[model samples]
Target: MNKMVKGRIYTLIGAIGWGLSGACGQYLMNDSAVSPIYLTALRMIIAGVFLTILAFFKQPEQFKTLISTPKEMFQILYFGIFGLMLCQLTYLIAIHDSNAGTATVLQYTCPILIVIYVSLKEKTAPTVMEFAAIFFALVGTFVIATHGNPFNLSLTPAGLFWGIISAFTYALYTLLPGKLIYRWGSLIVTGLGLLSGGILFYIGSASWQYTIQWKPYTFIAFIGIIGIGTIFAYTLYLEGVSLIGPVQGSLLASAEPISSVFFSIILLGEVFQGIDIVGIVLILIAVYLITMKEQLQEKHMRIKH
Candidate 1:
Protein backbone atom coordinates (compact mmCIF):
# COMPACT_ATOMS: atom_id res chain seq x y z
CA MET A 1 0.00 0.00 0.00
CA ASN A 2 0.98 3.59 -0.56
CA LYS A 3 1.92 5.86 2.33
CA MET A 4 -1.40 7.68 2.18
CA VAL A 5 -3.39 4.49 2.39
CA LYS A 6 -1.20 3.19 5.17
CA GLY A 7 -1.53 6.45 7.07
CA ARG A 8 -5.31 6.39 6.81
CA ILE A 9 -5.44 2.78 7.93
CA TYR A 10 -3.16 3.47 10.86
CA THR A 11 -5.17 6.51 11.85
CA LEU A 12 -8.44 4.55 11.69
CA ILE A 13 -6.97 1.71 13.72
CA GLY A 14 -5.68 4.16 16.30
CA ALA A 15 -9.07 5.81 16.55
CA ILE A 16 -10.82 2.45 16.95
CA GLY A 17 -8.29 1.43 19.57
CA TRP A 18 -9.00 4.58 21.57
CA GLY A 19 -12.74 4.12 21.19
CA LEU A 20 -12.43 0.54 22.40
CA SER A 21 -10.35 1.68 25.35
CA GLY A 22 -13.00 4.12 26.43
CA ALA A 23 -15.65 1.41 26.16
CA CYS A 24 -13.46 -0.96 28.13
CA GLY A 25 -12.86 1.73 30.73
CA GLN A 26 -16.59 2.22 31.14
CA TYR A 27 -17.10 -1.53 31.51
CA LEU A 28 -14.35 -1.86 34.07
CA MET A 29 -15.61 1.08 36.08
CA ASN A 30 -19.14 -0.28 36.09
CA ASP A 31 -18.47 -3.99 36.53
CA SER A 32 -15.38 -4.13 38.72
CA ALA A 33 -14.73 -2.60 42.11
CA VAL A 34 -11.78 -0.69 40.71
CA SER A 35 -11.55 2.96 41.52
CA PRO A 36 -11.04 5.35 38.60
CA ILE A 37 -7.93 6.71 40.26
CA TYR A 38 -6.41 3.28 40.70
CA LEU A 39 -7.34 2.22 37.18
CA THR A 40 -5.90 5.42 35.71
CA ALA A 41 -2.66 5.00 37.60
CA LEU A 42 -2.28 1.35 36.67
CA ARG A 43 -3.03 1.94 33.00
CA MET A 44 -0.59 4.81 32.83
CA ILE A 45 2.19 2.86 34.53
CA ILE A 46 1.84 -0.21 32.36
CA ALA A 47 1.43 1.73 29.13
CA GLY A 48 4.34 3.97 30.06
CA VAL A 49 6.56 0.99 30.69
CA PHE A 50 5.56 -0.60 27.42
CA LEU A 51 6.12 2.59 25.43
CA THR A 52 9.43 3.27 27.16
CA ILE A 53 10.70 -0.19 26.31
CA LEU A 54 9.59 0.25 22.72
CA ALA A 55 11.29 3.64 22.54
CA PHE A 56 14.50 2.23 23.96
CA PHE A 57 14.65 -0.37 21.23
CA LYS A 58 13.34 1.74 18.36
CA GLN A 59 15.11 5.04 19.01
CA PRO A 60 17.94 4.64 21.49
CA GLU A 61 19.67 7.85 20.40
CA GLN A 62 16.55 9.94 20.91
CA PHE A 63 15.92 8.22 24.23
CA LYS A 64 19.49 9.11 25.32
CA THR A 65 19.09 12.69 24.14
CA LEU A 66 15.69 12.96 25.84
CA ILE A 67 17.22 12.51 29.31
CA SER A 68 20.32 14.58 28.67
CA THR A 69 18.84 18.07 28.65
CA PRO A 70 17.68 19.48 31.99
CA LYS A 71 15.41 22.07 30.39
CA GLU A 72 13.69 19.53 28.16
CA MET A 73 13.53 17.12 31.07
CA PHE A 74 11.60 19.68 33.09
CA GLN A 75 9.31 20.37 30.18
CA ILE A 76 8.69 16.67 29.70
CA LEU A 77 7.95 16.27 33.41
CA TYR A 78 5.48 19.14 33.30
CA PHE A 79 3.86 17.79 30.16
CA GLY A 80 3.60 14.37 31.71
CA ILE A 81 1.97 15.62 34.89
CA PHE A 82 -0.29 18.41 33.79
CA GLY A 83 -0.94 17.26 30.27
CA LEU A 84 -0.97 13.47 30.14
CA MET A 85 -1.80 12.61 33.75
CA LEU A 86 -4.59 15.14 34.16
CA CYS A 87 -6.01 14.36 30.74
CA GLN A 88 -6.27 10.63 31.45
CA LEU A 89 -7.59 11.08 34.99
CA THR A 90 -10.30 13.51 34.00
CA TYR A 91 -11.30 11.44 30.96
CA LEU A 92 -11.65 8.29 33.03
CA ILE A 93 -13.61 10.19 35.60
CA ALA A 94 -15.97 11.31 32.88
CA ILE A 95 -16.38 7.73 31.76
CA HIS A 96 -17.10 6.63 35.32
CA ASP A 97 -19.70 9.33 35.78
CA SER A 98 -21.25 9.07 32.30
CA ASN A 99 -21.31 6.75 29.33
CA ALA A 100 -18.32 6.38 27.02
CA GLY A 101 -20.12 8.02 24.06
CA THR A 102 -20.99 11.16 25.97
CA ALA A 103 -17.51 11.52 27.40
CA THR A 104 -15.88 10.94 24.05
CA VAL A 105 -18.11 13.43 22.20
CA LEU A 106 -17.66 16.10 24.84
CA GLN A 107 -13.90 15.72 24.68
CA TYR A 108 -14.03 16.47 20.96
CA THR A 109 -14.76 20.07 21.88
CA CYS A 110 -11.02 20.57 22.30
CA PRO A 111 -10.69 21.93 18.79
CA ILE A 112 -13.10 24.72 19.58
CA LEU A 113 -11.10 25.50 22.71
CA ILE A 114 -7.97 25.56 20.60
CA VAL A 115 -9.58 28.04 18.24
CA ILE A 116 -10.54 30.34 21.09
CA TYR A 117 -7.10 30.15 22.63
CA VAL A 118 -5.25 30.84 19.41
CA SER A 119 -7.49 33.76 18.55
CA LEU A 120 -6.89 35.29 21.96
CA LYS A 121 -3.15 34.69 21.84
CA GLU A 122 -2.84 36.15 18.36
CA LYS A 123 -5.05 39.13 19.28
CA THR A 124 -7.33 38.51 16.33
CA ALA A 125 -10.98 37.75 15.91
CA PRO A 126 -11.98 34.28 14.85
CA THR A 127 -12.82 33.83 11.18
CA VAL A 128 -16.30 32.96 10.00
CA MET A 129 -15.66 29.27 9.86
CA GLU A 130 -14.21 29.32 13.34
CA PHE A 131 -17.24 31.17 14.63
CA ALA A 132 -19.49 28.60 13.04
CA ALA A 133 -17.51 25.76 14.57
CA ILE A 134 -17.64 27.34 18.00
CA PHE A 135 -21.36 27.89 17.75
CA PHE A 136 -22.00 24.32 16.67
CA ALA A 137 -19.78 23.02 19.43
CA LEU A 138 -21.62 25.03 22.08
CA VAL A 139 -25.02 24.00 20.83
CA GLY A 140 -23.89 20.41 20.52
CA THR A 141 -22.58 20.42 24.05
CA PHE A 142 -25.84 21.82 25.33
CA VAL A 143 -27.88 19.28 23.43
CA ILE A 144 -25.74 16.44 24.73
CA ALA A 145 -25.95 17.66 28.30
CA THR A 146 -29.62 18.61 28.23
CA HIS A 147 -31.00 16.00 25.86
CA GLY A 148 -32.95 18.61 23.86
CA ASN A 149 -34.41 20.28 26.94
CA PRO A 150 -32.80 23.57 27.85
CA PHE A 151 -33.44 23.22 31.58
CA ASN A 152 -32.98 19.54 32.17
CA LEU A 153 -29.46 18.14 31.98
CA SER A 154 -29.15 14.53 30.90
CA LEU A 155 -25.57 14.14 32.08
CA THR A 156 -24.63 14.43 35.70
CA PRO A 157 -22.93 17.62 36.84
CA ALA A 158 -19.73 15.76 37.71
CA GLY A 159 -19.64 14.10 34.31
CA LEU A 160 -20.14 17.38 32.48
CA PHE A 161 -17.49 19.12 34.53
CA TRP A 162 -14.88 16.42 34.07
CA GLY A 163 -15.70 15.99 30.40
CA ILE A 164 -15.05 19.68 29.68
CA ILE A 165 -11.94 19.59 31.80
CA SER A 166 -10.73 16.57 29.86
CA ALA A 167 -11.21 18.50 26.62
CA PHE A 168 -9.17 21.44 27.90
CA THR A 169 -6.40 19.23 29.23
CA TYR A 170 -6.34 17.29 25.99
CA ALA A 171 -5.77 20.55 24.11
CA LEU A 172 -2.93 21.36 26.46
CA TYR A 173 -1.54 17.88 25.99
CA THR A 174 -1.50 18.45 22.24
CA LEU A 175 -0.03 21.95 22.40
CA LEU A 176 2.52 21.67 25.23
CA PRO A 177 4.81 19.04 23.74
CA GLY A 178 5.36 20.47 20.26
CA LYS A 179 8.97 21.46 20.89
CA LEU A 180 9.88 18.23 22.58
CA ILE A 181 8.29 16.16 19.85
CA TYR A 182 10.16 18.18 17.21
CA ARG A 183 13.46 17.77 19.01
CA TRP A 184 13.27 14.19 20.19
CA GLY A 185 10.66 12.69 17.88
CA SER A 186 7.10 11.84 18.90
CA LEU A 187 7.89 8.32 20.15
CA ILE A 188 10.66 9.41 22.49
CA VAL A 189 8.79 12.42 23.81
CA THR A 190 5.57 10.49 24.23
CA GLY A 191 7.25 7.52 25.92
CA LEU A 192 9.10 9.68 28.43
CA GLY A 193 6.08 11.89 28.94
CA LEU A 194 3.88 8.88 29.65
CA LEU A 195 6.45 7.51 32.09
CA SER A 196 6.83 10.81 33.87
CA GLY A 197 3.10 11.42 34.06
CA GLY A 198 2.43 7.86 35.19
CA ILE A 199 5.02 8.20 37.92
CA LEU A 200 3.44 11.42 39.09
CA PHE A 201 -0.03 9.86 39.17
CA TYR A 202 1.23 6.83 41.07
CA ILE A 203 2.95 9.04 43.62
CA GLY A 204 0.02 11.40 44.07
CA SER A 205 -2.62 8.69 44.22
CA ALA A 206 -0.64 6.29 46.44
CA SER A 207 -1.95 3.57 44.15
CA TRP A 208 0.05 0.85 45.81
CA GLN A 209 -2.35 0.85 48.75
CA TYR A 210 -5.28 -0.15 46.59
CA THR A 211 -5.92 -3.88 46.64
CA ILE A 212 -6.75 -4.97 43.10
CA GLN A 213 -8.98 -7.97 42.45
CA TRP A 214 -7.39 -10.09 39.77
CA LYS A 215 -10.36 -11.49 37.88
CA PRO A 216 -10.02 -12.63 34.28
CA TYR A 217 -12.30 -9.87 33.03
CA THR A 218 -10.37 -7.30 35.04
CA PHE A 219 -7.12 -8.54 33.55
CA ILE A 220 -8.61 -8.34 30.07
CA ALA A 221 -9.83 -4.80 30.68
CA PHE A 222 -6.38 -3.83 31.88
CA ILE A 223 -4.84 -5.22 28.73
CA GLY A 224 -7.33 -3.31 26.61
CA ILE A 225 -6.71 -0.05 28.46
CA ILE A 226 -2.92 -0.30 28.68
CA GLY A 227 -1.83 -2.29 25.68
CA ILE A 228 -4.32 -1.47 22.93
CA GLY A 229 -5.68 1.84 24.17
CA THR A 230 -2.68 3.78 25.40
CA ILE A 231 0.41 2.25 23.85
CA PHE A 232 -0.86 1.07 20.51
CA ALA A 233 -3.25 3.95 19.90
CA TYR A 234 -0.62 6.56 20.69
CA THR A 235 2.01 4.84 18.64
CA LEU A 236 -0.20 4.30 15.62
CA TYR A 237 -1.65 7.80 15.72
CA LEU A 238 1.78 9.36 15.87
CA GLU A 239 2.95 7.22 12.99
CA GLY A 240 -0.14 8.21 11.03
CA VAL A 241 0.54 11.88 11.74
CA SER A 242 4.12 11.46 10.57
CA LEU A 243 2.91 10.06 7.30
CA ILE A 244 -0.24 12.11 6.62
CA GLY A 245 0.36 15.31 8.59
CA PRO A 246 -1.66 16.56 11.54
CA VAL A 247 -4.63 18.01 9.71
CA GLN A 248 -5.47 14.85 7.84
CA GLY A 249 -4.64 12.69 10.81
CA SER A 250 -6.99 14.66 13.00
CA LEU A 251 -9.71 14.53 10.38
CA LEU A 252 -9.35 10.78 10.29
CA ALA A 253 -9.43 10.56 14.07
CA SER A 254 -12.99 11.90 14.05
CA ALA A 255 -13.83 8.26 13.78
CA GLU A 256 -13.14 7.84 17.48
CA PRO A 257 -16.43 9.07 18.90
CA ILE A 258 -18.36 7.22 16.25
CA SER A 259 -16.67 4.02 17.28
CA SER A 260 -17.18 4.98 20.90
CA VAL A 261 -20.91 5.41 20.38
CA PHE A 262 -21.17 2.16 18.48
CA PHE A 263 -19.26 0.23 21.10
CA SER A 264 -21.14 1.88 23.94
CA ILE A 265 -24.49 0.82 22.51
CA ILE A 266 -23.40 -2.75 21.89
CA LEU A 267 -21.29 -3.35 25.00
CA LEU A 268 -22.82 -1.06 27.64
CA GLY A 269 -26.40 -0.82 26.42
CA GLU A 270 -26.29 2.97 26.57
CA VAL A 271 -29.39 4.39 25.00
CA PHE A 272 -28.95 7.24 22.58
CA GLN A 273 -32.00 9.36 22.05
CA GLY A 274 -32.71 11.51 18.98
CA ILE A 275 -31.33 14.65 20.60
CA ASP A 276 -28.20 12.86 21.66
CA ILE A 277 -27.59 11.63 18.15
CA VAL A 278 -28.17 15.11 16.78
CA GLY A 279 -25.70 16.48 19.31
CA ILE A 280 -23.09 14.00 18.23
CA VAL A 281 -23.62 14.80 14.58
CA LEU A 282 -23.25 18.52 15.18
CA ILE A 283 -20.05 18.13 17.15
CA LEU A 284 -18.60 15.87 14.47
CA ILE A 285 -19.65 18.27 11.75
CA ALA A 286 -17.95 21.11 13.58
CA VAL A 287 -14.76 19.12 13.80
CA TYR A 288 -14.98 18.11 10.19
CA LEU A 289 -15.48 21.69 9.08
CA ILE A 290 -12.52 22.93 11.06
CA THR A 291 -10.17 20.18 9.91
CA MET A 292 -11.32 20.45 6.33
CA LYS A 293 -10.62 24.17 6.40
CA GLU A 294 -7.10 23.53 7.63
CA GLN A 295 -6.54 20.92 4.96
CA LEU A 296 -7.76 23.35 2.32
CA GLN A 297 -5.47 26.10 3.58
CA GLU A 298 -2.53 23.73 3.38
CA LYS A 299 -3.43 22.85 -0.14
CA HIS A 300 -3.72 26.52 -1.06
CA MET A 301 -0.29 27.20 0.41
CA ARG A 302 1.22 24.36 -1.55
CA ILE A 303 -0.39 25.65 -4.72
CA LYS A 304 0.91 29.15 -4.06
CA HIS A 305 4.43 27.82 -3.50
Candidate 2:
Protein backbone atom coordinates (compact mmCIF):
# COMPACT_ATOMS: atom_id res chain seq x y z
CA MET A 1 0.00 0.00 0.00
CA ASN A 2 1.05 3.52 -0.68
CA LYS A 3 2.17 5.55 2.34
CA MET A 4 -0.48 8.16 1.63
CA VAL A 5 -3.13 5.47 1.57
CA LYS A 6 -1.88 4.16 4.88
CA GLY A 7 -1.97 7.67 6.29
CA ARG A 8 -5.59 8.10 5.24
CA ILE A 9 -6.52 4.79 6.85
CA TYR A 10 -4.72 5.72 10.03
CA THR A 11 -6.30 9.14 10.14
CA LEU A 12 -9.78 7.82 9.44
CA ILE A 13 -9.48 5.15 12.08
CA GLY A 14 -8.00 7.58 14.56
CA ALA A 15 -10.82 10.02 14.03
CA ILE A 16 -13.31 7.21 14.45
CA GLY A 17 -11.60 6.30 17.67
CA TRP A 18 -12.23 9.81 18.94
CA GLY A 19 -15.86 9.64 17.89
CA LEU A 20 -16.28 6.36 19.70
CA SER A 21 -14.73 7.88 22.81
CA GLY A 22 -17.55 10.38 23.00
CA ALA A 23 -20.13 7.64 22.81
CA CYS A 24 -18.25 5.77 25.53
CA GLY A 25 -18.48 8.85 27.71
CA GLN A 26 -22.20 9.11 27.18
CA TYR A 27 -22.56 5.45 28.05
CA LEU A 28 -20.51 5.73 31.21
CA MET A 29 -22.50 8.76 32.29
CA ASN A 30 -25.77 6.96 31.73
CA ASP A 31 -24.69 3.66 33.25
CA SER A 32 -22.19 4.49 35.98
CA ALA A 33 -21.62 6.68 39.01
CA VAL A 34 -18.55 8.61 37.96
CA SER A 35 -18.60 12.32 37.23
CA PRO A 36 -17.14 13.81 34.06
CA ILE A 37 -14.45 15.64 36.05
CA TYR A 38 -13.39 12.47 37.76
CA LEU A 39 -13.25 10.58 34.50
CA THR A 40 -11.12 13.30 32.94
CA ALA A 41 -8.57 13.15 35.74
CA LEU A 42 -8.35 9.40 35.58
CA ARG A 43 -8.03 9.39 31.81
CA MET A 44 -5.36 12.04 31.89
CA ILE A 45 -3.28 10.16 34.42
CA ILE A 46 -3.54 6.71 32.86
CA ALA A 47 -3.19 7.81 29.26
CA GLY A 48 -0.45 10.23 30.25
CA VAL A 49 1.60 7.52 31.88
CA PHE A 50 1.25 5.12 28.98
CA LEU A 51 2.05 7.76 26.37
CA THR A 52 5.05 9.14 28.25
CA ILE A 53 6.47 5.69 28.65
CA LEU A 54 5.97 5.11 24.94
CA ALA A 55 7.66 8.41 24.29
CA PHE A 56 10.63 7.49 26.44
CA PHE A 57 11.11 4.36 24.38
CA LYS A 58 10.29 5.65 20.89
CA GLN A 59 11.50 9.23 21.20
CA PRO A 60 13.92 9.17 24.08
CA GLU A 61 16.19 11.94 22.80
CA GLN A 62 13.37 14.32 22.00
CA PHE A 63 11.61 13.54 25.26
CA LYS A 64 14.73 14.12 27.29
CA THR A 65 15.50 17.37 25.49
CA LEU A 66 11.97 18.70 25.96
CA ILE A 67 12.00 17.93 29.68
CA SER A 68 15.38 19.49 30.20
CA THR A 69 14.36 22.88 28.88
CA PRO A 70 12.45 25.07 31.38
CA LYS A 71 10.55 27.13 28.79
CA GLU A 72 9.47 24.06 26.90
CA MET A 73 8.42 22.38 30.11
CA PHE A 74 6.24 25.36 31.03
CA GLN A 75 4.72 25.50 27.58
CA ILE A 76 3.92 21.78 27.52
CA LEU A 77 2.43 21.96 31.02
CA TYR A 78 0.25 24.90 30.06
CA PHE A 79 -0.76 23.16 26.88
CA GLY A 80 -1.69 20.11 28.91
CA ILE A 81 -3.84 21.93 31.45
CA PHE A 82 -5.36 24.58 29.23
CA GLY A 83 -5.49 22.75 25.91
CA LEU A 84 -5.94 19.00 26.23
CA MET A 85 -7.43 18.92 29.73
CA LEU A 86 -9.99 21.66 29.25
CA CYS A 87 -10.95 20.50 25.79
CA GLN A 88 -11.57 16.92 26.91
CA LEU A 89 -13.39 17.85 30.10
CA THR A 90 -15.64 20.41 28.43
CA TYR A 91 -16.51 18.06 25.59
CA LEU A 92 -17.40 15.38 28.14
CA ILE A 93 -19.49 17.87 30.09
CA ALA A 94 -21.25 18.77 26.89
CA ILE A 95 -21.92 15.09 26.31
CA HIS A 96 -23.28 14.82 29.84
CA ASP A 97 -25.51 17.83 29.25
CA SER A 98 -26.60 16.97 25.74
CA ASN A 99 -25.58 13.93 23.66
CA ALA A 100 -22.42 12.68 22.07
CA GLY A 101 -23.64 13.59 18.59
CA THR A 102 -24.48 17.16 19.54
CA ALA A 103 -21.30 17.74 21.51
CA THR A 104 -19.04 16.37 18.79
CA VAL A 105 -20.65 18.40 16.05
CA LEU A 106 -20.59 21.54 18.17
CA GLN A 107 -16.86 21.19 18.66
CA TYR A 108 -16.37 21.58 14.88
CA THR A 109 -16.64 25.31 15.46
CA CYS A 110 -12.90 25.19 16.19
CA PRO A 111 -12.02 25.83 12.55
CA ILE A 112 -14.05 29.03 12.47
CA LEU A 113 -12.36 30.24 15.62
CA ILE A 114 -8.99 29.38 14.14
CA VAL A 115 -9.73 31.30 10.93
CA ILE A 116 -10.77 34.38 12.85
CA TYR A 117 -7.72 34.18 15.11
CA VAL A 118 -5.32 33.85 12.21
CA SER A 119 -6.98 36.67 10.26
CA LEU A 120 -6.70 38.98 13.22
CA LYS A 121 -3.13 38.02 13.94
CA GLU A 122 -2.04 38.48 10.35
CA LYS A 123 -3.97 41.74 9.90
CA THR A 124 -5.42 40.45 6.67
CA ALA A 125 -8.93 39.89 5.44
CA PRO A 126 -10.26 36.39 5.10
CA THR A 127 -11.10 35.17 1.66
CA VAL A 128 -14.68 35.23 0.37
CA MET A 129 -14.90 31.53 1.08
CA GLU A 130 -13.83 32.12 4.65
CA PHE A 131 -16.57 34.70 5.16
CA ALA A 132 -19.06 32.22 3.73
CA ALA A 133 -17.70 29.57 6.05
CA ILE A 134 -18.11 31.83 9.05
CA PHE A 135 -21.69 32.55 8.04
CA PHE A 136 -22.42 28.86 7.64
CA ALA A 137 -20.82 28.03 10.97
CA LEU A 138 -22.77 30.68 12.88
CA VAL A 139 -26.00 29.71 11.22
CA GLY A 140 -25.32 26.06 11.85
CA THR A 141 -24.58 26.75 15.48
CA PHE A 142 -27.80 28.74 15.84
CA VAL A 143 -29.85 26.14 14.05
CA ILE A 144 -28.59 23.40 16.34
CA ALA A 145 -29.00 25.48 19.44
CA THR A 146 -32.57 26.51 18.62
CA HIS A 147 -33.70 23.65 16.39
CA GLY A 148 -34.21 26.42 13.84
CA ASN A 149 -36.85 28.01 16.02
CA PRO A 150 -36.19 31.72 16.22
CA PHE A 151 -38.68 32.10 19.02
CA ASN A 152 -37.04 29.76 21.54
CA LEU A 153 -33.81 28.01 22.31
CA SER A 154 -34.00 24.22 22.13
CA LEU A 155 -30.75 22.91 23.58
CA THR A 156 -29.89 23.06 27.22
CA PRO A 157 -27.99 26.19 28.25
CA ALA A 158 -25.19 24.18 29.85
CA GLY A 159 -24.70 22.12 26.73
CA LEU A 160 -24.44 25.17 24.53
CA PHE A 161 -22.04 26.93 26.87
CA TRP A 162 -19.63 24.05 27.32
CA GLY A 163 -19.78 23.13 23.64
CA ILE A 164 -18.80 26.65 22.64
CA ILE A 165 -16.02 26.78 25.21
CA SER A 166 -14.77 23.43 23.93
CA ALA A 167 -14.48 24.93 20.47
CA PHE A 168 -12.33 27.76 21.77
CA THR A 169 -10.14 25.34 23.64
CA TYR A 170 -9.89 23.10 20.59
CA ALA A 171 -8.66 26.07 18.59
CA LEU A 172 -6.13 26.82 21.28
CA TYR A 173 -5.11 23.16 21.23
CA THR A 174 -4.52 23.37 17.49
CA LEU A 175 -2.58 26.62 17.60
CA LEU A 176 -0.42 26.27 20.68
CA PRO A 177 1.46 23.11 19.81
CA GLY A 178 3.01 23.90 16.47
CA LYS A 179 6.41 24.92 17.75
CA LEU A 180 6.59 22.30 20.46
CA ILE A 181 5.28 19.45 18.33
CA TYR A 182 7.60 20.41 15.49
CA ARG A 183 10.65 20.48 17.72
CA TRP A 184 10.04 17.57 20.07
CA GLY A 185 7.41 15.65 18.11
CA SER A 186 3.82 15.01 19.11
CA LEU A 187 4.63 11.97 21.26
CA ILE A 188 6.82 13.78 23.73
CA VAL A 189 4.85 17.00 23.79
CA THR A 190 1.45 15.37 24.10
CA GLY A 191 2.70 12.83 26.64
CA LEU A 192 4.11 15.50 28.86
CA GLY A 193 1.04 17.64 28.35
CA LEU A 194 -1.25 14.80 29.33
CA LEU A 195 0.77 14.04 32.46
CA SER A 196 0.92 17.70 33.41
CA GLY A 197 -2.80 18.11 32.88
CA GLY A 198 -3.49 14.93 34.84
CA ILE A 199 -1.40 16.01 37.79
CA LEU A 200 -2.75 19.56 37.95
CA PHE A 201 -6.37 18.60 37.48
CA TYR A 202 -5.97 15.75 39.94
CA ILE A 203 -4.72 18.09 42.64
CA GLY A 204 -7.08 20.96 41.87
CA SER A 205 -10.29 19.01 41.49
CA ALA A 206 -9.58 16.48 44.25
CA SER A 207 -10.94 13.83 41.94
CA TRP A 208 -9.19 11.29 44.12
CA GLN A 209 -11.80 11.89 46.81
CA TYR A 210 -14.62 10.51 44.67
CA THR A 211 -15.47 6.84 44.46
CA ILE A 212 -15.86 5.40 40.96
CA GLN A 213 -18.17 2.55 40.10
CA TRP A 214 -16.13 -0.16 38.53
CA LYS A 215 -18.52 -2.43 36.62
CA PRO A 216 -17.72 -4.87 33.85
CA TYR A 217 -19.17 -2.89 30.95
CA THR A 218 -18.17 0.38 32.57
CA PHE A 219 -14.64 -0.91 32.81
CA ILE A 220 -14.74 -1.79 29.13
CA ALA A 221 -15.89 1.73 28.29
CA PHE A 222 -13.18 3.21 30.49
CA ILE A 223 -10.48 1.21 28.76
CA GLY A 224 -11.99 2.11 25.42
CA ILE A 225 -11.72 5.79 26.30
CA ILE A 226 -8.16 5.63 27.58
CA GLY A 227 -6.59 2.93 25.46
CA ILE A 228 -8.28 2.87 22.08
CA GLY A 229 -9.49 6.46 22.32
CA THR A 230 -6.81 8.61 23.89
CA ILE A 231 -3.53 6.80 23.38
CA PHE A 232 -4.10 5.12 20.03
CA ALA A 233 -6.23 7.93 18.68
CA TYR A 234 -3.66 10.57 19.46
CA THR A 235 -0.73 8.51 18.26
CA LEU A 236 -2.23 7.32 14.99
CA TYR A 237 -3.72 10.71 14.15
CA LEU A 238 -0.49 12.56 14.78
CA GLU A 239 1.49 9.99 12.84
CA GLY A 240 -0.96 10.28 9.95
CA VAL A 241 -0.72 14.05 9.99
CA SER A 242 3.04 13.84 9.82
CA LEU A 243 2.82 11.58 6.80
CA ILE A 244 -0.05 13.22 4.90
CA GLY A 245 0.15 16.77 6.24
CA PRO A 246 -2.24 18.64 8.51
CA VAL A 247 -4.66 19.81 5.84
CA GLN A 248 -5.53 16.35 4.61
CA GLY A 249 -5.46 14.87 8.06
CA SER A 250 -7.86 17.52 9.34
CA LEU A 251 -10.27 16.94 6.46
CA LEU A 252 -10.22 13.25 7.21
CA ALA A 253 -10.84 14.04 10.86
CA SER A 254 -14.41 15.06 10.04
CA ALA A 255 -15.07 11.38 10.47
CA GLU A 256 -15.07 11.88 14.25
CA PRO A 257 -18.37 13.76 14.40
CA ILE A 258 -19.95 11.54 11.80
CA SER A 259 -19.03 8.47 13.78
CA SER A 260 -20.17 10.11 16.99
CA VAL A 261 -23.57 10.80 15.49
CA PHE A 262 -23.76 7.31 14.09
CA PHE A 263 -22.85 5.75 17.42
CA SER A 264 -25.41 7.93 19.18
CA ILE A 265 -28.14 6.92 16.77
CA ILE A 266 -27.32 3.23 16.78
CA LEU A 267 -26.23 2.60 20.36
CA LEU A 268 -28.06 5.25 22.35
CA GLY A 269 -31.37 5.20 20.45
CA GLU A 270 -31.10 8.95 20.03
CA VAL A 271 -33.19 10.68 17.45
CA PHE A 272 -31.90 13.60 15.46
CA GLN A 273 -34.27 16.37 14.67
CA GLY A 274 -34.45 17.25 10.96
CA ILE A 275 -33.29 20.72 11.82
CA ASP A 276 -30.34 19.23 13.66
CA ILE A 277 -29.30 17.29 10.56
CA VAL A 278 -29.50 20.44 8.45
CA GLY A 279 -27.41 22.33 10.94
CA ILE A 280 -24.83 19.58 11.07
CA VAL A 281 -24.55 19.63 7.28
CA LEU A 282 -23.98 23.33 7.32
CA ILE A 283 -21.30 23.07 9.98
CA LEU A 284 -19.60 20.33 7.98
CA ILE A 285 -19.69 22.52 4.90
CA ALA A 286 -18.16 25.32 6.89
CA VAL A 287 -15.32 23.04 7.93
CA TYR A 288 -14.87 21.85 4.35
CA LEU A 289 -14.64 25.41 3.10
CA ILE A 290 -12.05 26.37 5.67
CA THR A 291 -10.00 23.34 4.69
CA MET A 292 -10.23 24.39 1.09
CA LYS A 293 -8.64 27.68 2.05
CA GLU A 294 -5.74 25.89 3.68
CA GLN A 295 -5.35 23.62 0.67
CA LEU A 296 -5.15 26.58 -1.66
CA GLN A 297 -2.57 28.28 0.52
CA GLU A 298 -0.45 25.18 0.57
CA LYS A 299 -0.65 24.91 -3.19
CA HIS A 300 0.29 28.57 -3.55
CA MET A 301 3.28 28.11 -1.26
CA ARG A 302 4.45 25.04 -3.15
CA ILE A 303 4.19 26.80 -6.49
CA LYS A 304 5.95 29.92 -5.19
CA HIS A 305 8.78 27.98 -3.72
The total of clashing pairs for model 2 equals 0
Stretches off by above 4 angstroms in model 1 are 213-216
Error of 1 at 287 (Å): 0.8
Q: What would the per-residue lDDT of candidate 1 be over residues 61-157, giving only the tens digit for each residue?
A: 8788768888998998899888888888889999999989999999999999999999999999998998999999999999999987878889999
lDDT for model 2, on a 0 to 1 scale? 0.90
lDDT of 2 by residue, 1-305 (tens): 89999999999999999998898888887778779999898888888998899899997887788788999899999899889998889999999999999999999989999989999999999899999999999999999999877778788999999899889989888888889888888888888899998999999999978876777789888877888888899889988888899899999999999899998998778899889999999999999999988999999999999
* Best-fitting candidate, scored by lDDT: 2
TM-score of every candidate: 0.97, 0.97
Q: lDDT, candidate 2, residue 19?
A: 91
After superposing candidate 2, which stretches have Cα over 4 Å from the reference?
214-216
> What's the count of clashing pairs in each model shown?
0, 0
Residue pairs in clash, model 2: none
